[model samples]
Target chain A: MKSFLSLLIAFVAINTELFAAEAGMPQLDPTYWASQAFWLILVFTILYISISKFYLPKIKDNLDNRENKIKEDLENANKFKEESEAKLKEYDLILENAKKEVLKIHFESKSTLDKDIQSKKESMEKEIEKEILKAQKEISELKKNSISSIQIISGSIVSNIIENISGDKLNESSIKATVEDVSKKNMNKFL
Target chain B: MQQFTVQRIGPEINIVGVDLSFTNASLFMVISAAVIMLFLFLGSKEKKVIPNKLQLIAEMSYTFVAKMISDTAGSKARPYFPFIFSLFMFVLFCNMVGMLPYSFTVTSHIIVTLIMALFIFIAVTIIGFIKHGFKYLSIFVPSGVPAVLLPLITIIEIISYLSRPVSLSVRLFANMMAGHTMLKVFGGFVVSLGILGGWLPLSFSVALTGLEILVAFLQAYVFAILTCIYLNDALNLHH
Candidate 1:
């Protein structure tokens, strides 16, 4: 602040005298000022052109390049996201197929176990049916053989008893009764 | 009150090793430039999404230039946006700086404004020639005119087109010089009068100051917009 004040004071002290000298010196014609203005403008135009060509265009190009880079990055990001989503979809389908294969294997295993159990049950039933038929045939055959023996023994015993009881008459019936009586007494020797 | 006077303050290039120098007006011009730079830099420091007081001023200036470029130059002129923006801001700052209590307006000088206007004139002319080659000369030729009137109409068109720089610079410099001189003269009157007599001139000065502010903004707008129009002539030279 002090330096600025001093500079201002110095400029004031210097310019005041210069202005006095220039003033009251009969003004330069107005047309001269206009001509000076014309030349000054020419100089300014040259400066602006130099600056515009050298400095401004580079600044503008830098700005444009930055904008273009941002746009390109955004586009690339979108494409990458799309590609990743496609890969994700493919992975999901593969995962789903693998699950289905596991389920199919489990179902086939269970059905095979069930088939084995059903076959074992059917063979066991057939064997039991065959054993039951054989046992029935043996029992019937033994009963027939025992019935004939018992009938013959009973006939002889009845004849011997008739003969002992009724001494007098017999005839054909009497012969049977005498035989039965003889079988009962000597029973063994009876004819 | 004491009389104002000028005296030697410093040395420069001289006939006998004495220093050459500047004047009171030149000194004030340097001060004006400094003040303008300070105000603009400070005003922009608090740039916010929603502006504070200083930022509002800065934003208003930005909007002013943007609107001018869009209106006069059209969308094609958008590529030159920053240059036009800087020009408007610089001129506007210089004008407002002059409105301070004891400040001198550098823009009141023909040298300053003529420098500006001349640059625009040359730049636009060069751009026209470059863009359209020799065909740009047809801008001076009147269209659909009778063959007998061709020479007369062509002279009128040439004079009108040639007067652009004069009109552009003079409007700004003359207005600034006239307004300040009037203000100074009226200020002398108010000081010379006492008590009740001073009131009328004081009030008038106040209204004039307000009007001067509006003129200041308008002058800056006119300058920038005219530049845009010239730019359009270069890019698209319409009859």
Candidate 2:
């Protein structure tokens, strides 16, 4: 209140000084001051009322709405980006799992195939050994049969030559015994 | 001088002892207010997310004043934004309308500017008192002053404080009045000097008109910013 009163006093003092100095100036005219003041106050009041009541709120709302929309749009964009990133991570995980699956299958099949091959090879080797032993026994029997035939043929020939040369069918048993003894002594050479 | 005269218009009207007669000043004031209202009305009527030129101007003016207040007075001055915005638009439109040929400049009058300044002065003083109580008086006393010089500093501070309204009102009035007067004086020179010699003064008048328009906007800006500064002092009470 003191400040307001002092303000009024100061205003009067300043107005008086200004008015006294510029008495001829039209702005200093006291008669028009009242009307000017009245109209100024009236017009300014209407302006203030209309602005505060009507226009400012409208502008504020528009700005606020636009700001909210922009914020919403930005948030949506961020959400979409994050979603895509998550999808990408999921895709990568699936690809890794598939790769692991393929490796597992490959190892499983490889081990099964290796076991089958090992058994087949073992059976094949057993069959081959059995065939080799049978062939060896057959070859020894053929050799033994050929050697006895040769010995028999040689003894007949020798006996026939001696009968023709000596012109005597001398004692068959003694001849046969001599032939057997000689054959036994010279068997290695004849064969 | 003739331009500044508040000629009576229509019938004489008086209320109490005051001359409530509608004058040219009143008419222009009404015109300025109407122009502002119309501008705001048309600007906000659509309220599109994408604003047209008129709406753009309206929004710009709002934000302009909004930023000005926030910049100078901080958020504490938000409640008074409308008053300050209206004041700026009124003064700006008045000055702009006055720039028209044969138009009377409302701010050229001392009484008009003084009224506004005194009102702001009182309002800000009241706000200061309300906000700080007796501590508001400490505004007149400077800190860090030697005790011996404190009295002189306090007296100076009070005088300066009281002179706020006077200076605020006078600064605007003098600038508008002087700028308009110079333009009129130059215009007279252009007419008095015949065509051949008239070119110089005519050119000078052109330059002065441009300068006056700039001053018109500048004075309104200065007026509003000063009001914000005063509002800041009242609200914050910083030395």
Candidate 3:
């Protein structure tokens, strides 16, 4: 440090002596060094204080705030998007269930209608069979009565014809018996 | 010579044999400081998410210096950010202000730059000693050197280390002073040559002016980055 100070003094002395005649380069003049250093220190100190204390912190805060705001917005957007996606999924599920419900109802109604139609058809067929049976019974009875009446008519006619031709009358029971025998032998051929 | 003159602004102020009078140099320093403060004040006034042009410039400058420090000195240099930032901006503004007609260039003066460089050198040296104690002296010695050549290499390293402040200060001062002198010389040529022959020197002057502006910014950048490097060396002692 002592050597450095001596060197600086020597350098300053040499410069002053050399440039004394021409006033020298103003930068090398030793007279202004003190004030320059002083003001430099003063101005620099103020600058440092103002910058660190006021400017940088404010700028940093702004940047931090902007970053935080952007982050929050992104998170919110993501959350909303997720919610919407979930809602969409829920909507789809609801639609699918509604569709399934519709199909089930349609199938159930169709099955019920088919069952009702089948039962009605069966009851109608049974009623028609019963009516047919009853009709068949009545027809058989009529047939029997008609056959007996025919037998009686034929016997009476036979008796009338005999009486007219031979002047002799047959008894009723014998005539009926003769008619029944004739009818029984020729029924299949005549019918 | 008049460009570098340090004329006294107010009355002479001598406190205990020291001439501490404010000068034009002091005024310009204040102006530089005020301009920086105003710019920052304007930039930070609104604090908008979407920055205006002024704010963008301010923020970009801050980020630029921050990135420079981080890139050169790493995160450990974060605490000294304001000092380096002020130094850079002060030098940069001084150089830029000097570019204007009739404005004084502060960094062009060897005294101003030398003082700053010395301060950085002293501070960095002290920090190294504080952090690493006697081990800080090891920076002057190269590891894995041949025993015979180690002394020579150590001497060379010490010389280089001692020369850091001189080199740093001279580089900035010389660049500013030389560039401005060249500009002035060309300007003189343009004026002396009249309209017919003036065009050449005038054009050269124009180009030189542009170069000087770039140099102005570059010198400030070099100044700050070198400080960071020095800080890096101090904080992280390397052989």
Candidate 4:
């Protein structure tokens, strides 16, 4: 409160004197020019030193740092892009190799299965042919046997019929010889 | 007019017969300088990658002055950036501070502006002489001019060159002083005219105050830009 009071007093005192002055042209007052100029010089020098030494450099550093950071970020982005591109290429190559490998395995398995099937089919056909040939031979043999039996039966019947009808019996030796001769002739015809 | 008067704040001291009294003008000058210093110091403290408002203002002012110097004086004037920057800030602050009610305008005084202008003029002249030697005088002799009119042209050129500091200082001091005086005069009218009649002058005073603000900024810019131009002429020796 005392300080504020003194300040008010000082202000009044200063204004009182300021009012007493004629107020014609303050700029033309030669008495104050020297002091104003001196103060100006002193204050300006101090300001210049402070600005040049400290303030300006800090602002400059901020700008330079931003520039460098941007440059670094750009470089990093470029590097990441290249790396991803390389990875994509590698992935494509691996995928292509896998596809080729799969195709090769498929073809190899197919060929092996075909060969196995073909061999199995060929063996089955050979077995069927052998069985057919054996059955054919048996049929031919049965036909030959049946034909002989039929001839023998027919000769016996003829002999009986001749013996009954004539009432006098022929000689057994002759009959037998005749039958043998006839049967021989008949076998030669059939054969 | 009373506002323009310089009041001594304390006891007057005589140094080698020179009266160096701490006056209102000195106080205001010191205040302006301190304000500039504090503003810059606080504004630049953070140094963030992404700047806040204060930092942005600080940075803007820095670039503003930098661009002004480069535009007017080119790269050769880079070495004198501190002086030019100081002058601009000081003048700009003084002008701005004067806008506050009952505050002193340091730039209103011819001596202050004269000192600054004279210093710039002398410094630039010294630089020109040192760099170009006696050939610096050839600036007065235009190449296309006939020899018959050479003397007249030379004299005119010398006069014009000598008038640079006078015009530079007077331009700032007069503008500031005149604007403040007009404001004071209008303010007086407003007080004397009473409530009903005061409104018109009050409105005019408002308008004039806005104009004065613009003039304040422009005068500072003109002062700094003119300094840069003069510096350019000296440094580059432009024909």
Best of the two (1, 3) by DockQ: 3
Residues B1-239, model 2: lDDT tens digits: 66787889999888887788999999999999999999999999996888899999999999999999999999999999999999999999999999999999999999999999999999999999999999999999988999999999999999999999999999999999999877876676555555755677688889998898899999999999999999999999877
Model 2 residue A186 lDDT?
76
Residue-wise C-alpha lDDT for candidate 3, range B2-82, written one tens digit per residue: 688899987999999999998999999999999999999998899788899998898899889999999998999999998
- Model 1 chain A TM-score equals 0.39
Tens digits of per-residue lDDT for model 3 on A46-84? 999999898998887887888899999999999999999
Per-prediction backbone clash count: 16, 0, 0, 0
Worst 10 residues of 4 chain A by lDDT: A7-16
TM-score of chain A of each: 0.39, 0.46, 0.48, 0.49
Model 1 interface DockQ:
0.04
Tens-place lDDT per residue, model 1, A1-191, is 58655654554455455445556421222523433343334433443453345433443344355567778989999999999999999999999999999999999999999999999989998888888888878777765554444445555555556667975434555555555565457633522
Per-model C-alpha RMSD: 12.9, 11.1, 9.9, 9.5
Q: lDDT score, residue B121, model 4?
A: 94
Candidate 3 backbone overlaps, count: 0
Which stretches in model 4 have alpha-carbon errors above 4 Å?
Answer: A1-23, A113-191
TM-score of each: 0.54, 0.74, 0.77, 0.77
- The regions of model 3 sitting more than 4 angstroms off are A1-23, A114-191
Candidates 1 and 2, the one with greater lDDT:
2
Going through the candidates in order, the fraction of native interface contacts each one reproduces equals 0.05, 0.77, 0.74, 0.73
Candidate 1, residues B1-239: lDDT per residue as tens digits? Answer: 01122222344324354233444444544454455455555555542444567656655665566677887878878777766765665566667777886765656766678778887898889988988999898888867889999998889988977899999989998887667755765565466454645666678788889888888888988898889998987787777
lDDT, candidate 4, A3-75, per-residue tens: 6556545644654465457546877879877788788888888888988888888888887887898899999
Candidate 4 residue pairs in backbone clash? none
